[model samples]
Target: MSLESFGEQLRRAREAKQMSLGEVADATRISLKFLQAIEAGKFSILPQAYIRAFIREYARAVDLDPEKTIQQYDMANQEIRATAEEWVSRSRNAALRQTKERTREIASLPVFSQRSVTIFAVLVVAAVAVVYLLNVGSDSSQQDDVSEIAFDKVIRESEAATVRTESGRALPTFEARDDSLRLEITTIDSVWLAITIDNTRRGEYLFAPQRKRTWVGKEQFQISIGNAGAASFKLNGVELGMLGNRGVVARNVLITRSGVQKTQQ
Candidate 1:
C-alpha cells in the first residue's frame, strides 16, 4: 500500500474512535503539527525514529494494532526509499554523462600558452582578493548593525522596566500588567516552532539563526520546538534558557504569567 493509503487507514481508524487530532496529541504527548503531518503522510517532517515512535503512539491512541500498523508503514517507507534510490541513480548517470560531454568539449578547445595561463590565473586571484576584502567589509558593517540593535534592545528594555503611569507614578513592568503574558523567542539556529497564544491563536513558524520575536497573550502560551536547543526563551523579560539538548524536540511547553511548565518528550 502507498504511504497516503496507510495514512488514510490511520485517519479512518481515528475517525471511528471519534478522536480529534488535538485529542490524540493530548493523549500521546505528540505535537498537533506532527499529528497533522502523519495523517497527511508527511513522515519526512521528523526523523525516522521519532516518526516510528509517534506512529506507534498514534496507533495505540486510536486502538489500532501497533505492530501491524508499523509493518504497513515500513512497507510504504521501503517503497519510498526504493523510488528515491532509483531517482538518485538516474541523476548520477545523467551527471556523469554531462561531465563526460563537458570534458570532450574542453579537450576540443585551443590550449593557452603558459604565459597567458599564468596571467589569467593572476587576474583571477586579484579579482578573488578584491571580492574577499569587500565581503569582509560588508561583514564588519553587519556586525556593527547587530551590535547597535542589541544595544538599543537593552536600552528599550531597561526603560520599559520602569514606566511612568499617566498620573506620573512609576510602575514596575510586571505590576503594570493585568494578567498579560509575554513570550520572547530568540533563535540560535534554524528551527521550527508551533505557538499557541491564550489557547486561541495558534501559529507555526520556521526561524533562521539570530532571529528574535515576541508574542503577547492574555493568559498563556503553549509552544512546541522542533530543535529545542536551537532557541532561547524569555518570559516577561526574564531569560528561560534553552528548552532541551541539541537536536531534541520539545512539545507542550506551557507558559503563563506564573512560570514555565515543561513536558519532557
Candidate 2:
C-alpha cells in the first residue's frame, strides 16, 4: 500500500491493457508530465491538495481503483495531513527542489532538441541505408541476403477472379470461422501465397521454395504470380518473394504461430 507499491501496480495495469503513457494522457486529456510524476511516486511534485485529485483522474483513466490507491497513499504517509508547520516544511522543500530542477533543465536546453532530432534522423537514415543495401544485394549476386526480394508479373488465370482495387485485387483467400487468421498460397507459373488476418502480424510461415521466391507484406502477405524463372511468388496479385535457382518448385519455411494453421482431419 506504499506509494512505491501503488505506482508499480498502476504501471502494471496500464501495460496489461497495451497502453502507452502518451495514450493514457491523450485519452484522459491529462498532461504527460503530471502523469509521469504520478507514476514516479513524486507526489510532492504536484500541489498537495491536487495529489488525490490527480490520482483519481489517473486511476479512472487506467481503470484502477482510485479510492484504494488514495487510501494506500495515506497509510504509507500517515503524517501527510499534519500541522501547518509540517505542511510548510514540505511545501518549501518541494518548491526548492523544483527550482533546482528547472535551473538544471534550462542550462541543458540548448542542445537537447537538436540532439533528439539528430538521433531520430540518424535512425531513419540507417533504416533507409539498410533497405538500399538489401535491394542492392538482391540485384547483385549475393547469397547471404535475408531481406526479401520481389518481382512482379500478371496472372492470366487469376485475372478473371480477382477483385481489383487501387492497391491491388482482393482475391478470395481461405478463412476459418473459428480462427482470427489464415494464410493460403496458390499459383500455376509460380506459387501464390496469401495471408489475410484480423490481427496485426502475430506470426509468419516460411516456405523456402526450390527457386528463389519473392515474398512481400502488403495488406497481409504477397508474392509474385507469373514468370518462368526458377523463383517467383504472388499474393493478392502483387509479386513479392523471389528465389534464384532454376529447376526448383517449393521450399520449406518456418511458419510462426504454429497452432493457428488449419489441418483437415
Candidate 3:
C-alpha cells in the first residue's frame, strides 16, 4: 500500500460516514488544513510526532480503528523519512505560526493599567519638583547643597512609597503541595508539544528556542513532544533529561508528582 492509497482509504471511510472535513476538524479539534493535508497524503505538512496522533483522531472521527489505521500508515510510509534538517525546519515554521497567533491575542489586551497611569503621573510630578528645586538653587552654593539634600530625600521617599505600593499589590507566593504536580518545560530549540493535564485539559504549543513554560496538574500529565531532545522537563523541580535523541518523536509520556512514569517513543 502506498501513502496515497492509504490516504484514499481514509478519505473513503470518512465519505462512507457522510462526514465533511470541516465536521471532522471541529469534532477532533484538528486544524482544517491538517485534515486536508491528511486526505491529500501530505503528511509532511505536520511534525512527524503529530502525524500519528492526528491520524488516530481522524480515524476515530471516521469510525475507523485508530491503531489499525496508524499501523497501516506506518507501513505505507516506511520508505519515506524526514531528515533532521527537515524536522528543524518544520518546528521553526510551527513556532512562527504560534508566535503570530500569540501576537494577535496579545494585541487585543489592554495596553496600560490604572496603576501604571497613576505611577506615571507621580513620576511626572516628581520630575517637575526636582527641576524647580534645581533652578532655584542655581544662584548660590549653599542653596545648591540644600537642593541636593532635598533631591536625595525626595528620591528616597519616592522609592520607599513605590516599594510599599508594590508590596501591597504583589501576588502571594505559590507553595507546592504533596498532591499537586508542577511540570516545567524548557526548550533549547523549536519544538512542538501536546499536553493533557489530569486527562481533562489539553493544549498544544509550539515553542521557540530558549522558551520556558510551566503547567500544574493534580493527578498526572500526558505529553507528546516533537524534537524531544531539544527540550527538557522538570517535574516538581526534579529534572528529567531529554526524552529522546535529537529530531525524535516521543509520545504519551506520563508524569506525576512522584516523577516521570513512562516515556514512549
Tens-digit lDDT string for candidate 1 (4-72)? 888889999999999998899777656576788899887754445456667877898899998899999
Worst 10 residues of 1 by lDDT: 140-149
User: Ten consecutive residues with minimal summed lDDT in candidate 2?
Assistant: 256-265
| Residue ranges of candidate 1 with Cα displaced over 4 Å | 25-37, 40-60, 63-75, 87-180, 208-210, 245-249, 262-264
Model 2 CA lDDT for position 31: 48
In candidate 1, position 73 carries an lDDT of 96
Per-model TM-score on C-alpha atoms: 0.49, 0.30, 0.42
Please tell me which predicted candidate would have the highest TM-score against the true structure: 1
Task: State each model's CA lDDT, in order.
Answer: 0.70, 0.45, 0.69
TM-score of 3: 0.42
Error of 2 at 40 (Å): 0.9
Candidate 3 residue runs with Cα over 4 Å from true position: 1-33, 41-179
User: How many clashing residue pairs, candidate 1?
Assistant: 0
lDDT of 3 by residue, 11-40 (tens): 999999999988996566565666888988
